[model samples]
Target: MSGTWQCSPAELEVHLGFRESNPQSKHAEFLGPPFLTVCCLLPSFSRLDMDRFLMRNVTKGTTTVKRKKSLDNDDDVETAEDTETMQRSQKISKKNNFDDENEPQTERIETLCQTFSEILTTDLVWKKVIKSNLDLSHTILFSKGIANTVMELLEEEVVYFTGDLAKVQVFGRWHNIPRKQATYGDPGLTYKYSGKETPGRAWPPVVKAVRDLVNRVTGYHYNFVLINRYKDGQDKMGEHKDDERELHPDTPIASLSLGQTRDFYFRHQDTRPPKKLNIDKVQMPLHHGTLLLMNPPTNRYWYHALPPRATAKGVRVNLTFRKVVPAAASSSSNNKQ
Candidate 1:
């Protein structure tokens, strides 16, 4: 239960004890009689939902006013007016207005939920839960305006590392890698990519926003995001299993795609009987503004990649958000690569 909440007086309160609390003021103003009639009346909504709602409604006060022994003015109290201001501001802002990215992303998404909260849980446009070797879900995340916004952010804010592909020791000898890539994550999140140590860079704001959205839809806390920029049909990826030593095996990997749609290929790592022939090799078209979540053993047995489409002319951006353990930490725990 929300601690010590006061109800504001209104006809609705009498009908339902839930009060019309002010958003701007410090506390809800209670004036009318106690609410008797109700359709499941409560001081506030769900604690989890309210936690996010409050962040969306409240803003940093301009001045640090100490708890005065006496009231400075009734205006010092928070009220519906403040909440109205927050609502209007939130509706107008579709971009990353919140500068602090380190705070919990669920709180950020919860803020967005306040705008039209009833539909927050229904955000995944076409979510399909798979009960197979992998804990996977293929869901479309954005459409129309929101999709456009994501594209713009990807184009303007996210910077790709454009340089000669580093010659990594593949089968022993060094070989240049294809596709431009960038990695963002917490400090010291290093992984072996093509026999090269790839240390993660600090997380970006927009990237963090995308990660938050994925977490909201998939319920996974992804700490590292590896972005692959396919400039055109020429840039491609090789089929490889993500069974690496650093990755947390059970932690599912979430991939968010933007820009061009591409055919992503997948196949089994080991030979299976005819009953599993359908999954021996499969091609799934990953469309723009969609989320593909690959869960456990999938990484352990399935190898996936985006082959050179040749026909695809448009650029495609894909972010594989994952959780990686620190090298020292991974050394101790026998986690599946």
Candidate 2:
């Protein structure tokens, strides 16, 4: 047929492999192999018929493809009619395939999006359970066995960001500090890890606290965490959503605030007058050992930020535990901090 047989690259590779494995016998070699090549030129056709078939098929497939050969070699090639018939058929098949591809399969697509959203957003009630769970984990932090494990992690999971400051931008504010943009660009303590072999070590006491709490409360297993330490009240995070493409679009983001309680604010992204929520919304003082669960639509609809306090308060440590899918580890772009 005239048109290029549209096929996946993977399929093409398989076809080529097949060709290498088995060469055709002399008779069929002129026509093409049984499976791979288009049957455009037939042996029964006269040379003139083959030329006409070739021209027709070429026109049918696309005016774009440039096939080089002498059409006048009637004896060597099939009749033009046969060639034209094959070409027209191939072109129609390609057009049909293209139409099928472009049509939207809405029901299937919606199902996928629903499944993805379910994975991303945690249930609301679990946020409360995680809060209680973190309280229990605090006891484990001081235990001898736990302390030893933590010590091991401390030594193993220390990641240092040295050299120039990395660029960090938030809400149009730009911060260019030359340091690794922590995975998913989380705003937390950029702890120094010992080596790649010791990656999981970064999640110790505080990390475990969040992890266990999230697992118990929401049935989520968090694989990675970004810990940010704000030394003074001046250190703050501007309004932003944790929608970095690296994160699983459907998984929930669990944030645990330890140490001092800074005023956390939330606003819907697209609303005029911007509906706002504060620490008071949770009916808690935003004290030590607080966990906030940002479920699905929460991110899609709102943005959160920890504004700087006018007076310097105590140091604050915030850990954001996420179900990181490292499969999508795209290199950080200039858009991130």
Please, what is the whole-model Cα lDDT of each candidate in the order they appear? 0.52, 0.38
Candidate 2: regions farther than 4 A off: 1-160, 164-166, 169-213, 272-285, 330-337
Clash counts for the predictions, in order: 14, 44
- List model 2 lDDT by residue over 1-337, tens digit each: 0001224444332222212111231111111111111122211122222342222223222322212456455345434544565465445334333223233434323322222232221222121212211111111011111222222333334353333323332234553321122332223212221111112344434344435545665567776676655666666554445665555666777666655556654444443123343221111223343456666655555545555554647756666676645544323222222
True-vs-predicted CA distance for residue 249, candidate 1, Å: 1.7
| Superposed Cα deviation of residue 336, candidate 2 (Å) | 12
Per-residue lDDT of model 1, residues 103-136, tens digit only: 3645544433332222243322343434346455
What 10-residue stretch in candidate 2 is worst by lDDT?
A: 132-141
lDDT of 1: 0.52
Q: Top TM-score: which candidate number?
A: 1
Task: Specify the highest-lDDT model's number.
Answer: 1
Write down the TM-score of every candidate. 0.59, 0.41
